[model samples]
Target: THIFGKFKFQSKQGSIEDYELGDLIGKGAYGEVFQAVHKETGKNYAIKVYDRYQMTQANKLKSINNEIKIIRRLDHPNLVKLFSVHETVTNIYLVMELVTGVPLSDYIKQK
Candidate 1:
């Protein structure tokens, strides 16, 4: 899920090399979000890449897993839709419906 840069993500399903990451849209304490595209399908997505090593605590990992489940099931027009989840030894990648607007970095900068 390190595709936020040039890293490749491998899951049981397959390599996420199908998509190449574009500009970063958001960054946080643990991870960053990047816009990505499917090479074959030409579809766009917002990929949330989480640094697994940063959330090494058991409780934090559990919380992340729980959040994945919750986001996967959520259906809302305003919220990003979870399209897929891919995890590796280092990161967790959340493939989501791309919604454009303000970047989190800008919001944080204003605060």
Candidate 2:
């Protein structure tokens, strides 16, 4: 089955042309988050790239919509802002505010 089989939205719905992606910052169960810069504005951001294969394996297809919904509603100093979403046949990209700091979960796990 195509990984996008269960997705309510279509793939390749948007473009990644505006931002130049940089180094990877973190890896999650279905994706890797990277540092990115907007080409025209030069603003920095964190972009999460979710692999279609990984999402299918992890059963996170619906989580994509859920994530976008949650991120769009968040308004807090500590939470990064969601800027946009870009996609391809095999990957989903989440453009977000660049937030620099040790993740609380990681910090706590070290204790």
Candidate 3:
């Protein structure tokens, strides 16, 4: 499934049973970011799904993995928290804290 010039594909290995995926909130080179709700806790999170094919093509798999490792060790109030990680044969899901604030560029422009 392709949406707005972005490729949308389902994961074959990961189970999304715990998450109720909502609208496509954002898009990037690797994949799309979806607003997801945890079924058990009713907590909202931003699930960034990275397509395996795209990551491989960009040679970003190792970089992404390294990023995850670094994020897992972070506990700062300013940083978006990394809650969990889910991997599929076709995609990787990064469950992250949903932060609300003005974009840096927008803030700069206003100033």
Local accuracy by lDDT, each model: 0.76, 0.78, 0.76
Please write out the lDDT profile of model 2 over residues 1-111, one tens digit for every residue: 433343323435234767899999998777899999988889898998989778878888788878888988999987889877766777878888988888778899999
lDDT for each residue of candidate 3 in 2-110, tens digit (9 for 90 to 100): 2211211333423456899998878888899888998888989889998989988999888887888899898999898987677666787888887656756679999
Write down the TM-score of every candidate.
Answer: 0.75, 0.78, 0.78
Relative to the unseen true structure, what is the C-alpha lDDT of residue 98 in candidate 2, on a scale of 0 to 100? 86
**Runs in model 2 with CA error above 4 Å?**
1-14, 109-111
Model 1 stretches with alpha carbons more than 4 Å out: 1-14, 57-59, 104-111
Per-candidate clashes, comma-separated: 0, 0, 0
C-alpha RMSD values across all candidates: 6.0, 4.2, 7.4
RMSD of 3: 7.4
TM-score of model number 3: 0.78
**Model 1 lDDT, full chain set:** 0.76
